[model samples]
Target: MIRLAVVGVGKMGLSHLSILGAHPQVRIEAVCDTSGYLLDVLGKYTGVTGYSDYEKMLERADLDAVVIATPTRAHATMVRAALERGLHVFCEKPLTLRSEDSEALARLAEERGLHCQVGYHNRFVAAFSEVKRLLELGAIGEVTHALAEAYGPVVLRPKGGTWRSRSAEGGGCLYDYAAHPLDLLAWYLGEPRAVGGTVMGRIFSADTEDEVYSTLFYPGGASAQLSVNWSDESFRKMTTRITLTGTAGRIVVDRQECQVYLRDTAVPPEGYHHGWNVRYTTELTPPVWFYLRGEEYSAEWAYFVDAVAGEPADGAAAGVNSFASAAVTDRVIEMLVADAAVPCGVAAASGTGASGAGVSGAAGAGPGSRGARKRAFWSLGKLRGE
Candidate 1:
């Protein structure tokens, strides 16, 4: 069994605890959180030890891996501490508030030979996973454009908020919501060369954005648009979808299903016709030992457990959403945040050509350029008033 410690016990954290507690190959070693009341309750019922101090927990617990579901601000420190203890880590999305930190953490984990995955669980979702498979199979030949969108009812009214509503904490709509589609975009396409026309709109929240809109330009002339709004009441829950247009056909996939349309000249994959076809998620999703909000939840944990156990079975094929991949997404988020701060108007006024200011400079830098990695520092410094 992979002895694991679960940190944080909030909404997403509690969900992870419940799912992982039922995992057949996992033994819950301990849980750590700041809330003693929540910890005491979990201990009384679940029979797992609990701790209020994270450092204390790390010092005493027998752990092979740690699943960290803390706030974005807490991730870098917590993950680094756990890695120093030589424990594998599964952290939540937007690995850290900054791409540089996420990249550094990725390198640290690699040096220690530990598995460090991020909770971009959309990668485990059947429809989204199918999209990746199809793209790999060239079912949609040479993707030309993609539109990734997400909508939910998160911040609809003005009120005092938790860490989620604060830009310095949870990163608001752009990080909390937009990161999902952004990660998927990076997974399907490579790192974006540049970001443009990024907009962060504040509908209800005073501190951070409620809606996010941006465009990502890729190296091969392909492009993607991101549209995310957390203030939409029409969605009963968060709904993320992606539309891909390629040379041969187009694919539209959401949590529920994948829709495909192919031109007459394109050759269809097996079981797919040379026209419109639909595949439900149930058919594509492999069965899980336990079910929760969705199979993807258990599926991701299962993948992590297998990886930690050093058993490369079917799980290895899907590929874990490693910290490395999350870094790519994080850098893209930084570019978006920097782009939203100052768009083409500011860039044009500053004689920086009209793409944007800092982001345009970042875009102009080669993907591997030092400027690309260091350009966002100025915008972040400006955001922090440093």
Candidate 2:
């Protein structure tokens, strides 16, 4: 069995614990958290040891790998400690608040010859995976533009203060929510060369932004737009959608389905037609041993475990969700943060009109002079932790 330890017993941490515990190839060697009460409760139920100190658990558990679900600020330190002790690591998204730290961790993992998977579970979603496959096969030809959006009711109110509202703790809709779509964009298209026309707004949260809008320009002239909001009550839960426009066709993907539209009568892949085709995720998603929010969660852990067990000393299999990939996503975040710093009027004056001129106004607002001023002021603040 692959012995494992889990740090941080918060929401995402507990989810990882449950899935890892259920895996037949894994043994829950220990769990760590600051809350004694939480440790006691989980220890009693899982029959696993618990510790208030992660270092103590690391010393005693004899673990082969660790899953880190701690707050953003704690990731670099915790991951460094675990890697130093020769443990494979599965860290949640935004591997670190900064790209340099993520690069350091990636290099460390390479030097140690250990598996390091970042938790961008959206990549494991069946439809998204299939979309990747199609893109690789040139299903839509050379991508010219793309759009990614995510919305949810995560921070509907400002009263219930949590770490998510504070930028220092990795709170904020940008890192916590928009990171998903941003990562998806980078994965589908190439890394962005430049970013401009950003809008970050606070609808409810006192400190963190509740909404984000940005435009990204890729090396090959392909461009992307990202829109995310955690204060949208219309979304019962988090919803992610991506649209890619290419030379030959276009593809659209949401949680439930992936739809493709071909501009010409070109031959298509199996289960797809030339004019228009739709594939439901229910028909495409693979089964997992356990399911929580989505099968992708369990699937990502399973992939990480397999990589830990089977990866060669060269660490080739680590590329799928590797820290390297997370670092690239971190770079995109860095660009977005930088773009948000520019004055809205300055961006528009430079011809980088919000999300491309005539495509969409900032945050669904019109091009009115008053709206432009509001958008400019809103985009000025730095993302808290950055």
Candidate 3:
């Protein structure tokens, strides 16, 4: 069994521990966290050893791999340390707040030939995975454009002044929530050429952003738009949807319920049924739909474990999530942070009227496009089961 060490006793870290501890292929060797009190409590409950310092834990634990769910700012340093020690790593999302740091880690992993999995959990969901498969088979027919939006009540920090309130910790609504939708978009299309957006912190006294609206442009006229906000008091919604109008057909995905509709042929014919039918083509049978099943996080963590076990990577069609997805996300955050002065509900001051034109260039180019090939290559590898 692979001996797994969990560094960070936060909510996510605990989730990782629970998930990993139960995996047949893994043994929860040790747990580390800055909070000695929390770790001690968890240790007593689980009968697992604990450490206050991650590095100290790493030094003493007989571990084959480490899962890093520390605060966002610490991701780079912690992941690098684990990888440098030749330990496979399963790190939480936004590998680093800065694109350069994330890129560096990606390079380091390549040089070390160590497995590194970044958390982009949605792609592992059965419904989202099915969408990935359909996109790979050209079910969406060369996606030309898409949109993703997520909205919910503002995030109030459980602690008043934690790292999550700082920009350095990647603590922004977009950074926290948009990553999923952005990753999904990249997976469906490709990376944007140039991305610009507005990020604002209007709803609360929080030090970071609460809202963002971004657009991404890809080659061959494909484009995508993403809007996210924590300022809304509306019903909580986490949607990774896409409306693809290809040369042949169209496909739409509602990630929350794993529902999809495809109109490949005609719209269910224009005629009515016999017998019990009262009307003719009144409903038109709608479009052919498919439903997906399974928990997203379970599938994602399971994949990470498999990758750590030497399974080939196949995340390309899914748009090299992990660090690559984080890169684009970072760019969006960059735009948001750069234009933070703009009110949460207002567009950038310029208001050129490109409809969130601030965030979209062309695909396969620009800083936002940083690791597309790596992402795509791994995706192809996955498709070939390499």
Candidate 4:
């Protein structure tokens, strides 16, 4: 059995703990949290050792791996410590607030030859996975443009006291919410070379943005538009949707279904055909032992467990959610921040002349030219609390 520990028993952390604890091949060794009361409360139900300090737990518990669901800021430190002790790691998304730190941690995991996975659970969703397969099979045919969007009622009021409201801590909507669709876009389409037309707006959060809109330009002239909002009550919970437009057809995917529309008759994979076709996720996804929130959560954990056991089947697809993949998402976050730094007026003015050089210069100003804006955007919520 793989002896495992969990750090930071928050919402996501608890979810990981539930799935990992239920895995027959896993033994719940220990759990750590900054709150002694929380540790006490959880220890009673889990029947596992608990510690208030992560380092103490690491030193005392005999563990083969750790699942980290700490805040974005603490991810780098916790991951480094886990990797230093030769433990496999499963960390939540937005691996780190900065791209450089994410790159460094990725390198550390690679040098140690450890299996590290990020919490991009969407990739495991049947509909999303099917979309990836279709794209690989050229179902859409040279995707020219894509739209990725996520909306939910997460923070409708001012979250002045929460870490999520602080950019330095949780990275606002871009890292917390938009990361999902952005990661999906990067996975389907290649990494974006440049990002522009960025806008971050604070609809509810006192500091961090609750809505983010941007455009990503890929290498082969392909482009993607991203829109995310955590304050949209129209969605009962977080809902992500992707629409891809290609030379021959278009594909749309959401939690429940995958729909394809072909302009001209074309051969598609089995169960799909020309004209308009729809496939429900229930038909394409395999069964899972347990289901909570979504089957993807359990599916991802199953994959991680198999990866830890050195199972060849999972090893082949191990890199699907590896840290290296997350690092690319981090880079996109960086690009968005840089793009947001450019003044709205400047962007508008550059677009007026329609000169390539003028627009490029405006977009190239990046984070270096407007670091203060980025800082202010991240710190506004925290400052409100102070």
Candidate 5:
């Protein structure tokens, strides 16, 4: 069995512990948190050592790996410390709020040959996995264009108040929630070639944007439009959908049921397109829940366990949630910030027509501290060029 230590006893961290408990091959060795009350409460059921200091837990526990679920700003330092000590890491999303730090951690993990998994869990949802397969089988002949949107409450608190509201803490909905759609799109299509968007801080008092709608043009003339909002209600009201248009047929996966549809035709085709036609032709069916639901967390954990054990078998293919992908998301967030000030495709005063500013900083450093602050350093030449 692989021994594990969970850092941070928040809801997410607790969820990880509970999910892993069901896996027979895993054992929870320790639970660490700064809250003494929380640590004591969780320690009772976990039956593991508890520590308010993560460093103390790491030094004392002879464990196989650690789950870093702390605040976004602390990801880089904590993840690096674990990998340097030869422990595999499973961290939550945005990997790091900044690109540079994420790059550094990726390099460090590669150098040490450690397994690092980020939190973009939607990749594991069976609905998406099936969508990827159907696309591979040419069910949706070459995807012409796609659009993804995730609108809900702003998960971040204000910098002075909570973690979700501050740009410095990576609190915006773009990084926290929309990350699923971004990663999903990138997975279905290829890497995004160009990304530009507009962010509006409409309702929220926090510094970062509460709503963002973006357009990403992919290679091969394919493009994707993304709309994400914290102010709207989407979870229970409208399910997430991915519409893929192709020459042969079009596939739609309503977070409810993964379904397929073809332009109405009298003659039926053969081979792979068999069972799915009747419903699309007849009437709308109930949404399909593709994943095992319970397996969402276990699948990821199992992959991490097997990968760390070195008995590898398509483990990486299961969806790594690497730092690089998080960097891409970071770039999109930066583009939104830059685009907010200046319209996309418009040439600035510098005579050169650069679209937006490239906010560079250490990965996982958070937005306000890096991207927001970096924009302040650029002069007219730099700004116009940016």
Candidate 6:
């Protein structure tokens, strides 16, 4: 059995603990968090050791892997400590608030041959997974344009916001909410060449943007638009969707289903037809050992467990949801951040009557300058590797 520990028994952490606790190949080694009461309660009832101090737990616990569900600010240090201890790590999403930190951790994990998985659970969603498959099968050949969106009722009438609303702590619609679709965009299309028309607006939260909108320019004439709003009460919960239009066909997908349309010239995949095909997520998803918030949640953990057990990944088409991929998503966020810093383009702002022209002189990152930044980002060695 693989010895495992869980840090930060928060909502997501507890869910992971519950799911992994039922895994036949995993042994609960220790649990750590700042709450002594929670630790005592767990230790007393669960027959598992608990510690209030993370460092102390790291020093005392014997483990093969760790699932870190700590706050965003604490992730870099905690993950570094775990990696230094020669333990594989499973970290919650947006691997780090900074791209450089994520790149560093990914490099360290690569050098050590340790599996470091990020918790981008949507990748495990069957409909989303099918998008990856269909794309690989050339169902939608040579995508020309795409739309990625995520909406939620998160910050409708924000009171004192939690760590999620603070930009410094990796909160905000851009990082906390938009990261979901942004990561999906990165997975579907490669890293964007540049970003423009970015609007990081705050609806209720004072510290961070409650909504995000941006345009991502990709290579080979393909482009994408990102639209996200966490303050949208129209959606009861967070909803993510992607729409792709290609030379051969089009695809639109959400958690529930994947809709595809193929041109007559396009050759359909095995189960798909030339006109239109719809595949529900329920039919695409396989059963998981433990069900939590969704099968995607447990499915992600199962992927991590299999990685720790040295099993081959689901397939190269599914891709490895590692720190490397998260870093790419971070870089895309960084691009959007830089783009939003430049003043919005208004026709009245310039005599040329061009809306694309911004007010900033040399201080702003425009399309040309941002593409150079993307080149530097892509220059990083094997940022897409295992």
Best by TM-score: 6
- In the range 95-136, model 6's lDDT, one tens digit per residue, is 998888999999999999999999888899999989988887
Expressed as tens digits, the lDDT of each residue in 113-178 for candidate 2 is: 998999998888888877888898788889999999999988877654677779888889999999
Q: Over the stretch 148-232, how does candidate 5's per-residue lDDT look in tens digits?
A: 8776544434334757667687676666667778778867886665555455655644466667677777778988888777667
Q: How many residue pairs clash in each candidate?
A: 0, 0, 10, 1, 16, 0
Cα misplacement distance, residue 175 of candidate 5 (Å): 1.4
Residue pairs with backbone overlap in model 4: 207-381
Better of 2 and 4 by lDDT: 4
31 in model 2: Cα distance from truth in Å?
A: 0.6
On lDDT, the candidate that comes out on top is: 1
Would you list the C-alpha lDDT of every candidate in the order shown? 0.87, 0.84, 0.64, 0.84, 0.67, 0.85
- Among all windows of 10 consecutive residues in model 6, the one with the lowest summed lDDT is 377-386
TM value for model 5: 0.78
Give candidate 4's error at residue 335 in angstroms: 0.6
**Candidate 1 deviant stretches above 4 angstroms:** 315-317, 343-386
TM-score, every prediction: 0.89, 0.88, 0.75, 0.89, 0.78, 0.90
Q: Considering lDDT, which of the candidate structures 4 and 5 is the better prediction for this target?
A: 4
Worst 10 residues of 1 by lDDT: 359-368
Clashing pairs in 1: none
TM-score of 1: 0.89
Positional deviation of residue 237's Cα in model 2 after best superposition, in angstroms: 0.5
Cα error, residue 375 of model 6, in Å, equals 16
The reply for model 6, stretches above 4 Å from the true place, is 316-318, 347-386
- Cα RMSD (angstroms) for every candidate in the order listed: 6.0, 6.1, 10.0, 6.3, 8.6, 4.3
